[model samples]
Structures are given as structure tokens and as C-alpha cells.
Target chain A: MGWISDFLLLNDPTLRVVVPGVLLLCGMSAAVGCFTFLRKKSLIGDAVSHSVLPGICIAFILNGEKNIFYFLLGAMISGLASVLIIDYLTKSRFARNDTAIALMLSVFFGLGIVLLTYIQHQGNASQAGLDSFLFGKAASLNKDDLMIFGISSLLIFLLIAFLLRGFSLVSFDDSFAMSIGFPVVWLKSLLSVLTVWSIATGIQAVGVVLMAALLIAPALAARMWTNSIIKMLLLAGIFGMLSGYSGAFVSYALPQMPTGPWIVVMASVIAFGSLLLAPRKGLFSQIIERNNNEKKILQENILKIFYHIDEKSGETQKAVLQEDLLNQRSFSNRNMRKGLRILERKNYLSNHLGAWSLTSSGRVEAKRIVRLHRLWELYLQEYLHLDPDHVHDDAEAMEHVITPEIEAQLDVLLGNPTIDPHQTQIPSKDE
Target chain B: MNSNDLWIVFTAIAVALICALPGCFLVLRRMAMVGDAISHAVLPGIVIAYLLSGSRNTMYILPGAAAAGMLVTVLIEWLQKRLRVQSDASIGLVYTLLFAIGVILVTAFTAQTDLDQECVLYGEIAYVPFDMMSIVDGGFSAPRQLWIASGLLTVLIIVITLGYRGLYLSTFDPGYATAIGISVVFWHYILMSMVSLAAVVSFESVGAVLVVALLTGPPAIASLFAKRLPLMLLLACVFGVLACVFGYLIASFLNASISGSIAVVIGVLYAFSLVIKKIFF
Candidate 1:
């Protein structure tokens, strides 16, 4: 509690404003970043962030001081100019988008560095902290800066809310939005404007170097947990806020640490966590699903083996020997034992004296599987004109995935074929 | 020009030339951002090397940074291939995270060394002449950065000369190259190694930010004017030298950072070429 209180810097009046200001700035960046991430224009945010540096430097030079309004205006103009230039370069077929981004980012940032160096060379005291814009100076953010962050963040949220339909449509499908008369160009430009504005305003908190991380990481993390755009936006905003707060907390506790990089580090942690640990799209879930799928395929293959053996032996052998089953298809001892246990538990098979025989229910299920397989093979052979031999491999893969609806369609398409391409009898459903 | 001015100009040109060679391939493969990613991500490697070796040996720094460069590549591949993250998003994610880690490390160890964050971002190119390393007992000496830059530039020229056709073939069409018994992956790592080498060497003199300008800016300008690969490579060196000269002049007149001025000059040259190309074609 003592450290926390001290970190909030409650003794300093100016420090009171920095927290919410950072929260607002980061939240807005995350919100805007969602659209950029979805649009596959993450690097554009990077270019805009770098482009705004010269704008800040130029504003300082013009005013001989740090006027937030001039900084905003200059940054907005140059940021938009970078966007336009990139669009022009790509659209003109002169350079690819990546090329344009790298080109503009380096060029604009290089110019910014020049101006910043010039400012420093002039030995102006006001320009002393200006270089902090490269890596951000969140602790020094004053009340006026907070006001700008607050109002800009509010405006960004409001515009996103009001124009949700237009923005989503444009981001997802611009040509369709245009065909439906949604002023696609204007909406895209508006999105670009919003992106530039968020980056330009948020520069003081995260800086040009890691601003792209703030824009990208939270949105990417949010996307992992939800599929809905609105939910993603809300989640990204929350993630952004958490990152900002935690980052501020760290930088406050450790005076040597910069807030911008800490914020980025926090956001990346959240993103990596989400990627590896989320329930649906996460690595763990995907791994579990893959394992389950492999198990199901194995079980299905075991069932097919039983049906083939029973059919070939003409039901004369009530109990097939384990040795016979092993001779027909390869299954390891442990796997065979486990498969038997699963079959026995499901009432799909009965083992008597170390020999396996299918139960009545199991026989019916096995027949259905064999029927679908042969039907697909026949369908492929007849309609697609594939060689009977060639159809087996594809049908083998398709059998497990064929839905009940697809099975019925295949049945109708095959015209109730009684046998497969190899002339094996396709068991009837009533068998 | 005075000897001091000559050293500065020579260092800039050498750095620019080294970067421009490999940068041509990056631009062609549409992987310019990879160059940016590697440059940013190599910070931790350099820092880690410095921390471990407790010295600024080229042997330690270059290899360490190269390992970090490869880590960036591997991390980006994992995110894109395994995690299913979007390509650009992955690039953005990995570099920033590594760079942030580097920033924290650099800050934590500020008392132990003179390698501050500002120096990494905006290098003291103007002070390069002062940090001279004597070759002939101070009678004929060059900036240490100049020596490293020239050495790396020599290695770059040798490798490019030997592997030019292979790099060109694989970059243009990997599948066809592989069909013809060329190893695309070999060329990829080789190019990446070169990128890391250039990034680490140039960063000491020009800083990470302006080094990126040198890597991408000159090649970008050459790409605009030249269609053939040889011509592009040739023109990139020419543009790089031109940008260095003009940038030096501009910095002197304006009393600005030399590296920053070089970047600005690169931008101006690009715009000028853009206009000329647009008008003539």
C-alpha cells in the first residue's frame, strides 16, 4: 500500500493528471489499432507514428515553444501526408505498400531527427525535453496535455460508436461498401484520419518507437478472446487501459524505467498470454482438439477393421482371434488394448477368450461407416471419372468428415449403388 | 575537405554502402519491413553481448546481434506459422517486444556503461571524428567506426560478388531456384546475417534510427530509377554517396546532427527522383 500510494505520486499535484491521461491515450490507440490490425495496415500506424516526429519538431521550431495545438496541427498534416503519399506510391504502381511504408517511415523519421538535432544545437532550454517524444515522457505530462488526451479519446470513441456500421463495412469490404453507396473512399479516409489522430495524440505517452506496439498488441490480444467487433473494441480498450496503468505503475516505482517501453512490454505479455492460453483459438485448445481428432480417427479405423473382418469371414467365426486381427491391420499392443477397452465400455464390442466380436449395435454402426465410404468411392469413380484405385485415398480421407447430410446427398448422387468401384457390397442401412 | 570532414563523410558512405547492398534484396522480396524488424530487434543481442563479454569486441557484438537477428526471424515465423498471427502484426509484435526488453536492459545498466538510450536512438555521428583509432601511431588514423564500416563493407562486397546470381535467382523466384538446385534457405540466412552485420556496425556510428534510413532510403531511391538488379545495386551506391555528401553539407550549414541530416537528404533525393521519374515516364 505504501509503495502504491507513493507510485500514484499523490504528493505531486501534476502527477494526479498523468494516470487518467495515459489511460485515455492508450485506450484510444488500442481502439484505433483494432481497425488497423483488421485492415492489415499495422505498419501504416508505424509510419504515421514516425512521420509525426518531424511534425512535433517543426511545431516547436515554429513557435519556439511547445504549443499543443500547433503540435497537433503539424502532426496531423504530416501524418495524413504520409498516408496519402504511401497510398499514391502503391496505387501508382511505383512501389509496394511495404516498400512505401519503410521508405516513408525512414525518410520522415530521418527528417524528424534532423529537426530535433537542429533544435538541440540551438541550445534552447524549452527544447530540452522535446527528444523525449521519441520514447515518450508520460511522467511529465501536464494538465493541458491531459485535456487534449481526454477530449481526443472521447471524440475517437464517439466517432467509432456513431460510425460503427460505416467503418466496419469499409474495413471488411470496401468495394461492397462502395457498391452499396456508403462513401467508401470518405470512410476509408476517415479511418485513416482517426488512426493518424490517435497516433499523433498518443505520441507523448508511448513515443514513435513503440507506439505501433500499443496500437497492435492490445488489439491482437483482444481479437484472440472474441470474434465480435464491438466486443473486440471494448476488450482492446480494457487491455490498453490495463497496460497503461501497469506500465505507469512500473515506471513510477522504478524511476529509471521509461513508461512507453514498459507499456509495450505489458501489452505484449497480454497478447502472448492470450495467444497461448485463450480457450478457443489458443495454442492449448488447438492442441487438445488435434489430439481428440486423432483419437476419433483411430476409433473409427478400428471399427472399420472389425466390419471388414466380419464381412470377409461371413459371420461364421463368432469370435475372431487377436492374432487374426493383428495379421489384417497394424495396431500396437498398447493401442489395441486401449481400443478394445473403449469399444467394450461403449458396448460396441465383446471380447471372449481373447477374441473380439462386434455387438449388434456395433455391427450396425460399422455397416453405416463402410456404406458411406464405399458410396463416396463410387460417387468419385462415377461422377469425377477417377480411377477406382485413385478414388480410394481421397474417399479414405473424406469418409470421416462426411456429415449425415452429405452422406444422404452422396447416396442420392450414386443412385443407391449396391456395390463400390471394387465391387464390394455396400451394406444397406437396415442390415 | 578537412581530414575530420573526410572521416565523417567516409564513415557515412561506407555504412550506407554496406546496408544498400543487402537492402536491394530486401526491397525486391517485398520484405523491407524485415530489415526494419531486424534492426530494432538486434538491440538486445548487442546489449547482451556487451554485458557478457564486458567489452565492445566485434567478434562478440556481431555474432550476438546476428543471433538476435535470427531470433527475430524465427519468432516471426513461429507467430505467423504456428500461432497464426498475421504477418505484419507478428513483425510489429516481435520487434517491439525485443526492443522494449533492450530498452529496459540498457536503462538498468546505465551506470555500468556509457551506452545510453539516446545514443542508441540518435547516434553521435558528429563526434565520430573525435573517437579516433590510430593505425600508424596517430600519424594516419581513422575513426573506429570508419574502420569497422570499411571492413564490413569489404566483406559485403566479397559475399555479394560471389553470391550475386544465387541471391538474385532465389529472391526473384524461390520455387524455380529450388527446382534448379539452388538452396533458397541458405541465401535467406546469408542475407539475414548480412543485415544483422550491417545493422550492428552502422548502429554504433549512426544509431538505430538513422541506420534504418541508410538501409532502406538509398535502395528505395535506386528501386525507383532502375529496373535491372545490377543497375539498381549500382544506382543505390551512387544515391547513398550523394545523400551522405549532401547531408553533410546540410548538417554543417544548419548545425544539425549529421546522421539526421543524411536521412533528410535521402528523403529529399527520393522526392526529387520521384518527381523526375513521374514527369519523364
Candidate 2:
């Protein structure tokens, strides 16, 4: 508690303003971003960012200073105009989406640069504040800016909460929404306007170049965890808050370090962590499961070897020579030893002359693994229309992992195929 | 208009016509930003030429600017092909870096007396009326930029018109053109160079920023109305000349900062054109 008080006293004004303000802005913007990401309109955020520059510049010139509301309104117009023009061109001509996006981004930024330079040459000191919009200077926030951020965030939050169902339906399947009389056009336009509003609000603090990342990264990071829309929104909000707060803190701890880039770095950290370690879909989890399953398969195969020898002679199969076991099947010596030890520990096999025979449970497990392998091959070849040569490889991988429910679905889909594509009979569970 | 004024107008339009001719072809290839890039990127070349000659010889300056323009094209193309950056991003990155480097070098190295960043960005089209076109026998009558711009424009038009079909096929679908044995890459370089040359000659007049407007806006506006490439080229040239005239008039009337205002006006005009298209369509 003393340390917390000391920390608050040290950063005095930062805690009151810049830090909280950025958190509010990044949070609201990222929530909006997740919707845009799902809608496949990510780089349109790029267009909005660049296009808003001229709006802000024009608004600054018109208002003779940084009047946030006027600047935001003016920016919203250009943002709408940019989207509408690109929309028109793409609709009317031979323009690819990338071309329209790239074109609008350059021309608008060029025009703004030209205007900005001209204004600078004119030597208006108020316009001096306009340079912050180029690369952003979030550390300079005051109470007024924070108030604007607070109100804007409140409004956006309300807008999202009130329209949650409509938004979800619109984002996931707009064509279906339209069929069901959801006024898709209005919803899209509303989203575009909100996007522009957030961009306009952000430009003075975080600038334009990094604003798109703020709009996209949090949601992208959140997406790695779950497919459920409600969870996605909540996780994205949390990630956004983490990035925003930590970025502000780092920038605070080290004087003169830019806030926006740190925010991006933190957000990317979360995105990368989720990419490699999220459950069910994370790289590490998948790799670990695959390793464990392979180990189980190896043990089962060794048990099968012991069972094969035991069934052949009916007495003292373990005393047979290892050479005889090698001739019976193409098992390597190292794998044969590992499998024999596992079976022996479980009391399923005794390798006296390196000829192993399985106990009852080991024989049953081996039969199940072989049955699954052949069943999947049957499913793929019959139901998937895959050729025999192609079916074997996929079946070979999926056989160890397919659950009973999946197998039941496969049975229903393939109508209980009795034979594999290679003319081998598929052993049923009962058999 | 007086007969002398008429003759000047004829010459000016004649020169502009040659320039506008190439502008048409460039407008089609969609290497419009290359013109903008070259126009700005030629400053180092000009500065270098002035350094070498210790004077602004049209001969030295033109080639110098052309060389610099070509260098920019090469840099942008290399960035595009080798790095696999998108052509648009490459254009933005290359031009900004070159323009900034030129500005910084000019400030850092030399006495801060002569040209500065604004002069480079805005150019001095207003003073073209003062530049004398001199020869051994012929007295200085015409502005030399007009003559050079017109001459280069003529060469550009002749080449483009001769290779117009090949160029059109290449622009519309390079894969199809390659299948048909067109040297798509060669024509692309030729087209890029022509834009570079056009930009070099016009660099002093329209300025660096507005040159982008001329190249992109006219073609884009022309495109809104025309379906055929030839018609689009013609309309683009007409729009280019109209923008110059109206831009000149508006700059004169407002007594505003001429070059910057002209660019703003062109932007406004492009927006108006978009609105018109939307309403009518």
C-alpha cells in the first residue's frame, strides 16, 4: 500500500489523465475492431486513418486550433467520403480492393502532407499542435482530452451493448441478416461512422499510422482463445486494457518513451502468446497431444507383438528367440525392447528370449488400435471420395485421434462400410 | 488577346499539347505515382547538376533531373520486385525517404542561402514566364521549360501511339500480353521512363505535389466517365489542361499561395467529380 501510494504520487498527473484516457480509447477502438475483423474490413481502417488526416487538418485550419469535437466531425466526413468513393470505384470499375485501398491511402495522405507542410510554412503556432497527429503524442493529454475520451468511450460502449444481437448477426452473416430483414446497409453505415469517430478521436493522441493496429490487434489476440462471440468480446476488452495500461506505465517509467508503439508491442506480445499457447488450438498443446498419442501407439504395437507370439505356440512364447520375432514382423530391435519393457512393467509381457507375448488387456488394446486405423481408412475412402492412395495417409494420422462420437458420425456418413479401400476387411468394435 | 499574346498562347498550348500527349499514355499505365515520385526525387539531381556546373544550365539540369528521376524509378522498382513490397507502399516509402534525404542534405551541407525544402516541394511555375529560351541566333523568346516539356512530350506521344496497342494490352492484362509475346516488362520500363521524363520537365511548373494531382486525378476522373482506354486518355489530357487553367485562374483571383492552393483546388475538383458521378450514375 505504501509502494502503491508512492507510485501514484510520483506520476501525479499521469495517473489522473494520460494513462486512464489511453486505456479508455484503446478499449473502445479494439471492441469496434473485432467486429471489423470478423466482417473482413480490416484495411478499411487503414483508409479511415489516412483519410482523417485531411479532415483534422482542415478542421484545425477552420477552427484556428485543436477543437476536438469540430476536428472529429470534420474527420468523420472525409472518412465517410473515402469509404464511399472506394466503394463506388470497386463497384463500378476494374479496381481490385487492394488497388482501391492503396490508392486512397496514398492520395489522401499526400494531399494532407501537402496541406500540413503549407500550414507549417505559414508559421501558425496553433497548427504546431497538429504535428502530433502525424505520429501521435499521447503523453500530452489533459483533463479536456480525457473527458472527451471518457464521453466517447461511454457512447461507444452504449452503442455496442444496445446493438449486440444485431451487430453479431450482421458481422457473422450479413447476407442472411439481410434476408431476415435486418437493415444491413444501415448497420454497416453505422459501423463505418463509429469507426471514423474512433479514428478521429484517436488521431490527436496516438496519430494515424499506429491507430489501425490499435483497432485490430486486441481483437486478433483475443480471437486465438475462443470461437464464442461473447467470450471473444470480453477477452478482447481485457487484452486491450492490458496493452493500454501497460503501455502507459512503461512510457511513464521511462520518461519520453512514446506510448503508442509500446501499446502495440504489448498487444503483439499477447497476440503471439495466444498464437503459440492457447488451449485446443495452440501450437504447444497440439504438439504435446500428438507426442503422447504416438507414445501410446508404440506401446500398443509392442503389446500386439507379444499377443501375436502368445497366440502362435500357446505355451512359453516368451522363451522363443528374438530372431524368430524379427522374422514374424518387421519390428526394429530398439522399438522391440522399449515395447517389451512397457508390457513387462504392466505384467502384459515377459521377454525371456526377446520373444514377447501380451496379457489379456494388452491384446484387447492392440485390437482396438488396429481396428480404429482400418475404420478411418474405410471412412475416408468411402465417404470423402478420396482415392485409395490418398486416403491412407490422412487415415494413418486421424486413426489415433478420432473419438467415439466422431467415429459414430463417420459410420452414419459412410453407411457402415465393411471393407477398407485396400480390400482389407474393417474390423468392427464387436468383432 | 493580342497577336503576340495569341502566338504565345499557341506556343504554350502547342508545348502543353506535346506534354499532355505523353500525359495521356502515362495516365493509362497506372504508373501515375511514378510521375509524382520522379518530380520530387529529381531535386537531388538538380542540386547535383548545379553543384557540378556551378550554374543552372538547362542542359545540365534537364539531364540531371532525368537521371535522378530514373534513379527513383529504379529504386522504387527494385524495392517492389526484390523486396516484394506492394508498388503503392514502395512508392510512398521511396518518395518520402528520397524527398526527406534531399531536404536534409540541402540544409546540412550547403550555405542556407539558396533553395530550401519549400522551393523543392512547390517548384516555381510562376517564374516560367521569366525563363528565357535562347539560341546562337534566335533571341530568348520562349520559356525553355515549355520547349523542353513540349519536345519530350512529342517524343513520348509518338512512341506511345506507335506502341499504343501493345501498351494497352500490357496495361489491361500483362499475363495475356506475355502470352501474346509482348515485352510487358520492356514497355513497363518505357512507360515508367516516359512518366519520369514528363515529370522532370513539368517539375518546375506544376511543382512536385500538384504533379501527382495531374497524373492521378485526371486519369481517375477520366476513368469515371470513359470505358475505352483511348477515350480515357483523351479525357484525361483535357482534364489535365482544364485543371491547369482553372487552377491558374483561381490562384490569380484569390491571390492565394498559388501552388498549394492549386493542389487543394484540384483535390476539390476531384471530389466534385466523384459526387457528380455518384449522382448521375
Best by lDDT: 1
Best by DockQ: 1
Q: Using TM-score, give the best candidate's number.
A: 1
Per-model TM-score of chain B: 0.96, 0.84
Q: What is the TM-score of chain A in candidate 2?
A: 0.84
The TM-score of candidate 1 is: 0.95
Residues B152-198 of candidate 2: C-alpha lDDT, one tens digit per residue: 77787788789987888888888999998999988877776776666
For model 1 the local lDDT of residue A59 reads 89
Query: Model 1, range B1-281, lDDT digits (tens) per residue?
Result: 79899989998899889989998899899888988899898888989988998988778888898899889988898999998999989999999999999888889887664689888887777778998886677486889889888999999999999998899999999999999999999999899889989988888778876777888888888998898999999999999999999999998999888888888888898889989998996
True contacts kept of 1: 0.82
Residues A1-431 of candidate 2 have per-residue lDDT tens digits of 55456445654766778777887888888888778777867667866877787787788778888787887888888888889877876786634454455457545755565567657767788777676675466788888889988999899889889988888899999989999999899888888888888888876555665566666667766777889887888888888788888877766766555566567667666765775678866667867877877677677655545545654566533455656666777777887667667667987655555445555565666656656677788776666778888876676567667788987887777777677788766556663
lDDT of 1 by residue, A1-431 (tens): 68777656665565588788889999999999999999989999988999999888888999999888999999999899999999998998778888889888888888898899888988899888888889999989998899989899889989999999999888788889999999988888999999999999888998888899999999999999999999999999999999999998899888779999999999999999999988889999999999887776767777888899888878722577777777878989777777778878989888888788888888887788888889999998898999999998887788788898998888888887798999999988674
User: Model 2: clashing residue pairs?
Assistant: A306-A356, A306-A357, A306-A358
What DockQ would you assign to candidate 2?
Answer: 0.07
